[model samples]
Target chain A: MKKLHYSELWCSSPRYWGGLAALTFIILLGMAAAYYMEHSGHWVTGMSNQVVWGLPHVFAIFLIVAASGALNVASIGSVFGGPLYKPLGRFSGLLAIGLLAGGLVVLLLDLGRPERLIVAITHYNFKSIFAWNIILYTGFFTIVGIYLWAMIDRKAQKFYQVTGFAAFFWRLALTTGTGSIFGFLVAREAYDAAIMAPMFIIMSFSYGLAFFIITLMSAYWWASRELGSHRLEKLKNLLGVFVGAVLYFSLVYHLTNLYITQHHGIERFILLDGGVYTVMFWLGQITIGGIIPLFMLYSPAFSDNRFAIAIASVMVLIGGFVQIYVIVIGGQAFPMNLFPGKEVVSSSFFDGVVAAYTPSLAEGVLGLAGIAIAMTLVAVGARMLKVLPESLEDPEQGTA
Target chain B: MSGNREQPKEIKRREFIGMTVLAAGAASVAPGILLTVAHATAEAEGASSEVRWGLLIDSNKCAESCNACVDACNRENGIDLLQRPQGQGDEMWDAQRPQWIRKVKLKDNQTGEVTNLPMMCQHCEFPPCVDVCPTAASFKRADGIVLVDRHTCIGCRYCMMACPYKARSFIHQNVEQQTLRSPRGKGCVESCNLCVHRIDAGATTTACQDACDKDGHQAILFGDLRDPESALSKALREKSSRQIRADLELNTGVRYTSL
Candidate 1:
């Protein structure tokens, strides 16, 4: 593949056309859902007070983390001076912006007082994690955008140098803020652990790397089939490493929780006794998210396959949904105030003393609707803004 | 700067009128604005900060048949039966129930049995609801009563997540949950105020406490916690009282003794 510019790839290809169409369809559906939710006043969605946040909250966080991860492609290679890793830099930055915007869309839809969201900026509650999250997310998005554009602008060379280092820390802080929203909720015994904040950070790394690796490996195909193959191997190896880390962190997180008897009951309620939630945690996260991806990544024959990496990315993403669910929904399922008394541990699971929640269809659809909106917007963005680069071919070192 | 001050006398008359209007605006907003925390403190001109308010209810003295406290609270708050949130049953448990008073069956360790007692907001010293509230709607007074602003409440119910007692309730669907009063709407959070409205009128106790007295059992006591002479404070000094879910570390105003 010869050295290429943005115009060459902007020309429509089968992959681009299909991707754009699918994305547009999803976004249109999301807009429809949002309209439905607004008129329905939240009752249209399955969300109840018991399960206050469902798919939208989890997916929004996922997109944010993924967005940060996408930025890592550029920030890592550029700011950290990854000389060999420089080839994929701008692509990462562009993807980062797209994903962040998607995350924001989902988040706004979930907010109880949507119109007053801006009002959140004016009325700051020092202790409120939700308020802090709004600032962190917006700030991170702006910095990532400026840093990326600075990379392209030959006129302003010095700005990139400052943003180069600043962007990495800014992204990290964004993920940290996201985690603290749940981690600092001392009242929710499930999320009370300090480890959760850091665990969530690690999750961002896993999801980010897995997503960026798959996207990069796939995008490289635009240059030619041969170019993507070599890059695919590099990404496959990186993903293997990331999967191992995700598994190790997940094990440590739960094991440490179990090491103490105090958390054992709730932990068991999640991992063991927590029926549907437990199955989803184990199957969606542990098996598909961890074991299957881990096994496939390790198997050279399978890991090298382009199809396999895509499958793994999808699996890992789905697994992330379960990971968040086990914490947020699983946490709420347990009685909110567990400071025990002669509390009747309700003999029946649903009827038990512990609070139980099941997502209604409205709840589930609203979540799906959020995803559709994000995909559609990103697709349209790629089309309108020329966010997708013209070339996937990497020029030799020092080539203008 | 010196010349401006001399010229201000001519303009001062206009400015004074403007200032008066601003003060009037402040006065109107102040009672409504300082609502989250100030109700208890606002009434405390005669009282002091050291004077904490607490409640003591003896379950043995409480008769299960009588719920005069519930009736009194409902009547006082103008909470009609319709506006009430689903209690422990309906889907959304974001603290929407507004009877403010409740009859719960808590276990008795000595008898190994469930005992019936009326319950309401504990009004904790370190109110979690206030801290997580995005708006300053949920707040605690210096005198230790936790209160909510009905007008400012966006009804996000983040406070519901924070409260250990699960004392707060959301007005799900609409305010018509209360049949007798003005419809408050679906999205506002309402809870036991410790009857701040009556307190402003110089009432010695809440409607619930007064109703309890009328019931003849004298099972409940409400008073200033600082004055040792108050029945509640004296009872606290005498009998060991336990707040519901004591492990939560909330310095709750609600206390009940085992039979």
Candidate 2:
């Protein structure tokens, strides 16, 4: 194979500074919104006792799950030994770290007492899935950091596979931990299942790959560089397979829930009368996120169309967000069955009623800030380091 | 390091008497307001696991219109004084406010039988809230009173999510003049600590029990599970009572009859 050349995006352009400036502004806005919510109290937001987590969690979790998936490129190159994917490894590692940092920032800021973050770190309850996740998340950063060094630095190149393999397993555990955050909740009918963990793994694969493809295309296009169709087709096919896997897992989750009499209520709510959640599941996750992407990727007419593949990737990302909203918010909206057969004739705390949540402007801005922060890190990292490769042409067909 | 060169003289007899009078006057004016002290004193003897505290309620005798226990709990915990934000509606504020206890009305599906009961923290032997709390802020005392340590609580509200009975409440807004008994603040999860202050002070009963007795309901009973002679234990032995969501096998301290 021909040797791959890597270089930084030129930093002198007006567009580069302009984009960075825009990202900085959004980060500041998000910080300000966080301060307003903290100072005025959570009462200003639409979130209540009923729905403890809101849009911020949805954004944070989606980015975190995608972060785990983003490292797949490096895993394929170093662990699985895919020659075409090896050149994209460095940037993939960078994107994974940047996305995780962004997600963590959003999650920490959304806390009721963000200042007590130190307490959460210090006070470890081993039984809690959340405490274990804290270790997994931090460990992921360290392992991925070493993995990146192994891939980039020539002297440390020998350790690439060792570190990559370790990272591969760590990221899987991290995603499983994330999925179990919901799965372990026996109180909520929607999440108490073993399928949630594996479903999350499948989702990470699809969402992470989608995010990686989009970032690669956008960065290359902006720099006026050629991202070869040969490489794009390989990524396109992998993304299609992951998306199909996600659909299969989702189908299994619903089918399994449907089979059980206890879970019938939650299944009905999501598949039928959950209103926005139902729309998000069918249109956002299934149609736009899954079915359409599969069609565009596999169809003979659009098989080679790079634009169609990119569009599919974007759809998957949108679908990923919709899926999270449905899981996090929709699950909470359904009332807990405190009394099995009896109806709650009256309750002081809006019991036995569907809880309503409207995302406020502050929450919306905070969610955007998470996206902007991730993109900014990616933008700055690309400009500063020799991450992106010159081309992905095979040695036999160098002219192509 | 050995600075015993000049020992200071003690205060004069007149100064001592004047200081004593001043302290007495201050104590009289404040009545139970020792601002620095927590209600549940950090006494040398911590709560004992041997003595399991619980509440027994006979819901059949619980008057439908009477919310004495709810009112008493609110007053004792300062939940009543919590103010709604300026623009929010009454219904919105009511739905969002911290509720330590509440009156719930339930109707059966088949028999169309109706019942009313005051519900609070079940104080389970194996609390899901305590189990899920990442910071260990939501903890069960040795005496089986599940309470939130506001000092350490990061207010993630995972406890609220884990609770099956909807017992825990998140403090949504800051309160100015909180009662000394329950100095609640914003950004923390809290629930009925089973009147831990009273329990710790050796009061032998709770405000809700007192209020119920005063209202002539005699529906609520409070005592220790370890002591078989306790009124609560005797009532449980005599009456056919059930724990809410007994299928979970949480072994709740609170039991209700005629539900």
Candidate 3:
């Protein structure tokens, strides 16, 4: 087998490398900000008491789901035996495993006491959604490890069939557990509904597809030189469906919250109020993450172009973060008890009652660090593992 | 320690068997939040089997004239003034703060409908805070009382998040300023310990309970939820008491009978 090689194209390709560099730079700034926050204190950032766990947590959770999801190769190969996808199989497992590792790093960095994360692991809190997530991440990582090793370690294919399925289902269960952490909060009224868990799974699928498609497309652009239109189209179409799923699920989730509980004042306050977060939810998540990607990909002209597909993929990443931010942060901003007194009027959403929380600069940077760390890992993995095929047999133009 | 992690060793058969046992043990524990910390605590060997502490609040008699419980609790626990008022950046946790408990008046009907509800931790039997606490820092004693262990609390504020009564508060700053009894200040969640310090000392009741214990006309009751023979439990049978937020299904330890 030919050892994988990095093309000069990777460095020269303004589109892919440029985006990668920009993402890296953004993440670097975030890292510096995070370090400062950790050294100084949470006060250095925008996070007030109202919105305690802000951007970093939201971004981390989004990254987590995305990381868990970016393992589509394991899902398709282990679940359905998609031999066409076999080349990408072990590599997908690597991405899934890598992204999760990165996500955990960002989350820990965001904590006021990173030292306690291990304490958290050793101590265990079956009741806290956050504690269970620690276990969930650990378990999910294990399954991916076994599955990836079985795929790549040569003497392992025979064992991997069992291992791959384990990894696939465990990742599914892990993501659901992650979702349930938010969903089971009967106290957090916004997060209590059944919709969130399934929404997470669907998001995993969409984000997983987006990540791989962009990565594979970048690799294909150089080594294969094939511009494999039909295959690329098929991949785009599949991604398009997940994007559609994201759109549909988001619409249903928000509308259901709005429609069923329209009279429920606090819920309505979140969905409609001039709260910046509410706007972000409606605009950034519902519009940018869901609709724009769908519009771009669902259209034939846009879907066919590799550049367009890549852009749509980027949108998926952004939109996913926005959506999670809305849930994790917005859920906290509302006072759970809803005590009415002479101080604040009944049925009024903004009677100096709204909890205020904003992610400090450190929180934002640390969040960025998560993304940077992911991209760096992917880049290194691509370079070292030779996961991307350095050669393609034939080529066809997109115009064909 | 910070870089790429080596591949985890594959689970050996022995480890698998061990994990299975652990999983089984974990499964036996209730699916709610308390399982996380059950091991950390020993079953308190208090004289159990007959102490049902209950509270009877005469809503008809509640006049917000005196907030003695807040004062007594503040003095007892060394809670700060929380001077910024509710919804501000003041870091201390106390009973009178917006995030914790407070007394308030509500009027309806335009003409009349005035009443006072001295609200605080209801200390539910099936505490949602206890159920959802990931670290299991928010613990319910074997005697049906809830207590927060300040040291173990990770400050995820999930208890604050899970609490239906809005009873818990997150210490925003390092709470070095504490009274001699339980000096917890920053980054941990605190609520009405229901005066646990007083209870453990074999006192008749908590400070608030004692303060409400006005001239034999009782306002707050403190006894074991497990005890059926206690006067508080006896009054529970006689008076139609209501919980602060029963809809949460926490099965609160403290019952309130509106007078």
Query: TM-score of every model?
Result: 0.83, 0.94, 0.80
lDDT of 3 by residue, B1-100 (tens): 4222432333465688899999988777756447434523433446343454445566555555666665666677766533433343433222213243
Q: Which is the leading candidate under lDDT?
A: 2
Query: In what order do the candidates fall by DockQ, top score first?
Result: 2, 1, 3
Best-to-worst ranking by lDDT: 2, 1, 3
Q: Give the winner by DockQ.
A: 2
lDDT of each: 0.67, 0.89, 0.67
Q: Report model 1's TM-score to 2 decimal places.
A: 0.83
Runs of candidate 3 exceeding 4 Å displacement: A1-52, A125-131, A217-227, A255-263, A337-352, A392-400, B1-49, B81-100, B108-112, B210-219, B226-231, B234-238
Candidate 2 segments exceeding 4 Å error: A394-400, B1-42
lDDT of 2 by residue, A1-400 (tens): 6677898877457777888999999999999999998898898888988888999999999999999999999899888988788889999999999899899998998888999999999998999998999999999999999998888789998888899999999999999999999998887899889999999988999999999999999888778787888889999999999999999999999999999988888898999998888999999999999999999999989977989999999999999999988999999999888888999999888878888888889987898899899999999988888899876544467533
What DockQ, on C-alphas, does every prediction get? 0.18, 0.71, 0.14
State the lDDT at A129 in candidate 1.
74
- Model 3 / residue A135 / CA error / Å: 2.5
The model with the greater DockQ, 2 or 3, is 2
What is the TM-score of chain A, computed separately for every candidate?
0.88, 0.97, 0.85
Model 1 local distance difference test score: 0.67
- In angstroms and one decimal each, the interface RMSD of every candidate reads 4.9, 0.9, 5.4
Please give the distance, in angstroms, between residue A377's alpha carbon in candidate 2 and its true position after superposition. Answer: 1.1
